[model samples]
Target: MTFNLETERLILRDLRMSDLEGMFELDSDPEVHKYLGNKPVKTKEESQKIIEAVIDQYEKYGIGRWALINKKTGEFMGWSGLKLNTKMNGITNFYDVGYRLIKRFWGQGYATESGKKAVDYGFKVLKLPELYGITEMEHQASHHALLKIGLKYIEDFYFEEEKIKLRWYKIENK
Candidate 1:
């Protein structure tokens, strides 16, 4: 499936192999992976593998994270979109809204902007009943972004797979 979602200053679209360089830059930063278990990929090949996985997800689940681009500069800032999270933290088959931009893009309100768009797409476009956002407890920026985008803090729980405590946030269509 092809997707093209545009916001005021950003564009969300399907991931492509050509985005490898930007994906490498975004995933290689240790700072960017601090909340992601500090597992910064060691090689561009690893980043390529991640891209492959996301592509597979797109084919398998019909929805996955999208490539986030700056409309003004046309740069691959990072990725932000929805994923069909089949199982995580005891939840099953949930639609998850998430974002991750390069450190340079951090603190620029991109997360909130993309997140709100993702949530709207889930509810309005996909007609999902609800959407979820998960973040590490200390990732205050993500926490604030989720809330800023209208997800309510639901609870705190241990993510066994990631081996970390996470804050769960959700918003339902009403």
Candidate 2:
């Protein structure tokens, strides 16, 4: 299934093969992945595989991370949307909201903007009971954005798989 969502200055849409370059640029940057295990993709093929995996999620789950595009410049800023995070860190599978933008676009409020929209989509459109956001404990920027988008910090716990402590945030549809 195909999807598109718009905010005041961004367009969130399904990932496509044409997004390879933008995805590579976003994923290859060490700064961009600093809070994400600090492991940047080494090749364009890796980015291609990431896109393919998201596409498969769209088919299987009806939702996944959407490409974040600058509506005005038509630039691919990165991606932000909802994902069904299946059992990881001993946490049961749950719907989560996430975002990633180019380092250049880091401080422009794009993450919170798109994240709020994703939360809306999750609750109103998908009818999910709750949504979550997880970030490395030191990622204050992401922590702030998640709060700004309405998620409240619930706990800090160790993710055995990554061997890192993470902050888990959540928001529920009342």
lDDT of each: 0.93, 0.94
Give the range of the ten consecutive residues with the poorest summed lDDT in model 2.
84-93
In TM-score terms, candidate 1 sits at 0.97
Among these predicted structures, which one has the highest lDDT?
2
Query: Model 2: runs farther than 4 Å from truth?
Result: none
What is the alpha-carbon RMSD of candidate 1 to the true structure?
Answer: 0.8
Please, what are the lDDT tens digits per residue for candidate 2 over residues 29-133?
A: 999999999899999999999999999999999999999999999999999999998876566879889999989999999999999999999999999999889
Q: lDDT by residue for model 1 over 104-169, one digit each (tens)? A: 999999999999999989889889999999999999999999999999999999988889889999
